[model samples]
Target: MYVTFVGHVIEWRGPAPFYFVRVPEDECAGIQEVASAATYGWGVIPVSARIGEIDFSTSLFPKDGGYLLPIKNAVRKPQNLSAGDEVTVEMTVRL
Candidate 1:
């Protein structure tokens, strides 16, 4: 099954490098696991993942405060993404 989400590229900071797309405040519940962590050795850790295709709209903010990009359903190899390129990601949710 495939789902669709609309958000903006917020940032990219992961062990394997993932996009941080921000969903709107009202639609935030549609996505889950939106949390942050502060590790003493690893520094700040942002937790975000979701199911289905994530479509980043053209309207994006210049600041790095958008919703977290959903990497859970990434279809293509996650390493192929960049910092600022808006994309429509397709993926399968792992069970």
Candidate 2:
């Protein structure tokens, strides 16, 4: 399943801060339908995603009944993405 949407980058402070793009509620509904087929385990969904021409593979984390798309540094640096930035994501769920 493939999906595209715009989301705001958010920062989560842990031992180290992390960045993510929270998937919108509307998009979550569609992803839920295919969640079972795509999730490897722990309700986390595997996906190939692109941001500003940088492509990477990561797992969507379940949060607040929705999903958080982790934006890794490898993909962030080149794109100059950071917290509070609005970004367009092209993602594909591998079933």
Encode model 2's per-residue lDDT on 1-95: one tens digit a residue: 88899999999999998999999998899999999999889999999999988889999999999999999999887888889999999999888
Error of 2 at 86 (Å): 0.6
Residue 44, model 1: Cα distance from true site in angstroms: 16
lDDT of 1 by residue, 12-65 (tens): 566865545555554433222322222122222233233233332221222233
Q: CA lDDT of 61 in candidate 1?
A: 22
Which residue pairs show backbone clashes in model 1?
20-69, 21-67, 21-69, 22-66, 22-67
The regions of model 2 sitting more than 4 angstroms off are: none
Error of 2 at 75 (Å): 0.8
Name the 10 consecutive residues with the lowest summed lDDT in model 2. 73-82
Q: Against the hidden true structure, what lDDT does model 1 obtain?
A: 0.37
How many backbone overlaps does candidate 2 show?
0
